[model samples]
Target: MNPAAPVHAIVLAGGRATRMGGVDKPAVVVGGRRMLDTALDAVNDCARIVVVGPRRSDLDSTVLQTQETPPGAGPVAGVAAGLAVLDAEPGDRVILLASDLPFAEPTMVEALAAAVQDADTVFAVDESGRLQFLLSAWRIGALTDRVRSLGSTVNQPMKALVPETFDTVLFRGVTDCDTPEDVERARGRAAASPVSIAEARRAILEVVPPLPPRSATLGTSLGATLAERLLAAEALPRIAVSAMDGYAVAGNGPWVLRDDIRYAGSSDELELADGEAARIATGAHLPSGATAVVRDEFAVVTNTSDGPQLSRSQDAPVRDDARRRGEDWHEGYRLAVEGTAVTPALVSAAASAEVTTAGVRGPVRAHVAVTGDEIRREGPLRRGQTRDALGPVLPQFLSWCGVRTVADTHLRDTSDSFDELFREVRQPDLIVIVGATGGGAADQLRAALDRAKARIVVGRVQCRPGGSQVTALLPDGRVVLGLPGNPYAAVATLLITVPSIVAALTGRTPAPRQLARIANASEVSGDATRILPAVPQPDGTWRVDPGIRTAHLAGIIDREALALVPAGAADGDLAELVPLPR
Candidate 1:
């Protein structure tokens, strides 16, 4: 990070002080320091400074002073004039701050610059959702281009000057000194970097995205988190039933047989009267007024002159064998709580409870595509051509990761195809593109990202088999994860990035990883973390399965896990076993 390249601040101090009763607001002192100097101090760490307005002796001498195209034109003109004299290179961050925000903290400026990671602009958003245009950070190149394109509209509102299609980062620390009350209120307010693979996972899980809660049918709710408690639609076992095949008898044993059997689907035909018993199958309703049940194996039915009689054996015990209504769950019973993952078992219970629908978090749709000119389907292997491994495999992996795929496509290595995918998928949670992620001759993911202006959050993973993994965030908050074209590398990176993506959408805290001790020692290289495929042993240890290659994923076929061996780690060391897909 070139501190020189990160931020170049432009202080818009040219606004006519009509709001301040014609006073030179930037020169006005606050907290025993000049407001202009206070603003300068806020961005003191920046490489260059351009204070747009009339120069003041009280202001810091280090800042360059410039006037709007027509002096005193609005803040937009001030921005244009600042850009005219702004000493910044392409990709440098441009911070636009007002000299009158006496309360603006220097740390806020740094934070804004840092947040310009996956966004074109990172500006202050007041609690009321108002855009604090002046107190914002922007890409120097994007801002410059937008300003130059404004032409005659350079003096229009700041909103008009900003690019229409750009991502914004909201900062809560941008209260202005437009009024004395605003100044007083701002003074009362107070304010308070990259990650490892585990650190990345933790950071992602910390994010609770804004996927709305939706009512989904039980069939479609699997793997989604329940957004509300699941109430029993009716109840499990809505009617009382026999828990086992037995004779429903009333009073003591030696009861007369009713001469009829009750099956599971049929209601009891005869309620047992005193000294009478009826045979009932499992799950069949116990006859009303029945007292006890004698197991068929433990009871005797004998033919007598006055109808058959049922009696318990000498040592046979009589017990109630009926399942009462709502025994498993009563009507309106809370079967599953909010935030619970809708598992198959949970769905089974829901079905038993007669629930047709559940309130669940909306499915996070991942639109997947594989990029590579050499990747072909429905063909035998040819020179420089590989099979379409990702199209068949990634969707299944995505399902296990709790992401639903709406489309799976295979495309050539071109920016047009990549950009078209972005244009096509409307508001997807994730866009997973396989292949062309590294800096190889045929790699086109990097160029596509540049063309789309995608902000790279996890630029690359420092892990073996997939060190070129890229996770970028689009302007719309959608994430784009580029996995290496190599099948092994793609699968390796997918195991790491996909779960993090899922956690980000669901806000699920990842369980702490337990290290797997490897028995046989293996030598490794590289400063990046190594993702070694391993087979878990019966004793909770990992047997390193070491033959992984870029062109093939055969090593991962029978492997149970991908172990994280950090840099400088030796043999016999316990490495973290990455959570497997699903």
Candidate 2:
């Protein structure tokens, strides 16, 4: 490749595949070639390729795999390592590809590269409009600066880097292969077309289920559908009591003219005779047989021996404030509608309409297991050791979807201890392990999960930053999620996977909301869904504010929302924003 046009592609392939019987995953055969080979083939035509992983000797491509900076640092570190390698060639951009992506398309790479002419980074978008981060392209300089400032730590999720600081481009095509099942699925789909519209549609339908029937009183998230929790109350008749300081009367018959009157108080014993009148306060009841009410200001008061008598002023007309029966309530009145998101106004309306408790399904609970020898509470850090940063934020992220952490415990990443921990936290709606998911002596999360007597459904997702994520459904109705130990990858996993599971469990679908604006240029290569962190601007647009990738707790505290940069976006793409539920 020409030196000036040295746009190198970095393929991340260092994840340990404990679910694949603890074998080398990138070397696994897919489409008659090693997974790495397939990924290189997809990108070789785009630019010079660099492989990022622990062992590059096994890879067939001519690309160089630099030992990960801050060994076992995480996906952000892996990206940083790749960027560091490409740093030698100033002005040269780096296109990132995950080795497990068997369904990557060259068109996406071209699109992303084309988009970078105007933006800082270009990311790929899947057919469903989600951004694919791993399969992305970035300018070497900015990415390197972000990595250096953020630090390449396992706890710092790479998505947290996305904020208003980076400009992004969205493209289509960066499907990744995270697990055996994902590889199989991609193979099955690849046999058809790289970007098969039909396959994309089918995948979307399979991933997102139809909404369940809702009640009229259910509130809605900003961009989510409203529940019909208050609809049942529509059958009841409603009366609109004056919401202001005004009088109520019937607008029938000529206004009665009277001078002497009795003030109706709480004493129900006081009754009005036919053609009689009374003086009433703002909320006082009108006298019987009185058809209209004349304001005290419009009335001429004459003091008499008995009491003050009232008569309408010469130029003032008698005003009528009537409360017609059933005026507010009528047949065919819609108390609420389907797909309408709940808001304060909706809640107030439901309350005014006398809606009682609303029926709502609770969110699905997910169990998280953090395993490591170095894990410690956040406090004074020992030299060469740090605290478990992801511990605090992970729970908060889950809580937003109403999914509570059933159990959280730290264990040594040993097969035996992991087995015990898994057994203890098992039976939750979902089980997530933070560390030891990758291949290493201490990385035993996937191994322990598989060894359990529970039926394990292990597979990887096709995307960047979190491609190594492993998910399984245990035989005992528990979902196990194994995340990379790196802080950045862990956070990304939570952002991408936890939300979906929570939405599934709580019946709250993940919907996009306008949270913030992108401040800098950030783009992805081919089509791949990418999620990033951002700070919300005063005007409601999210500014891409990068966060440290090593500390999960720190990142969460600093960032307000997750900005989703879609695949195939260019410099000025309007990425979808999902506010971190607090």
Best by lDDT: 1
Cα lDDT tens digits for candidate 1, 422-503: 7778767888988777677778777777677765555555567676677766677788888887777787788777876776
- Among all candidates shown, the one with the greatest TM-score: 1
Residue 570 of model 2 has an lDDT of 55
Model 1 TM-score is 0.64
The C-alpha TM-scores of every prediction are 0.64, 0.51
Please identify model 1 stretches exceeding 4 Å from their true place: 1-194, 207-210, 380-383, 440-442, 450-455, 507-514, 570-572, 579-582
Q: Give every collision pair in model 1.
A: 435-485
Q: Which residues of candidate 2, in runs, are more than 4 Å off?
A: 1-230, 234-240, 250-359, 378-385, 416-427, 448-458, 462-464, 513-519, 522-530, 535-548, 552-560, 566-569
Residue 117 error for model 2, in Å? 38
Model 2 — which ten-residue stretch has the worst lDDT? 193-202
Residues 340-398, candidate 2, lDDT per residue (tens digit)? 44446766666656664454443355667777878886678777665777776678767
Tell me the TM-score of model 2: 0.51
Q: Each candidate: how many clashes?
A: 1, 85
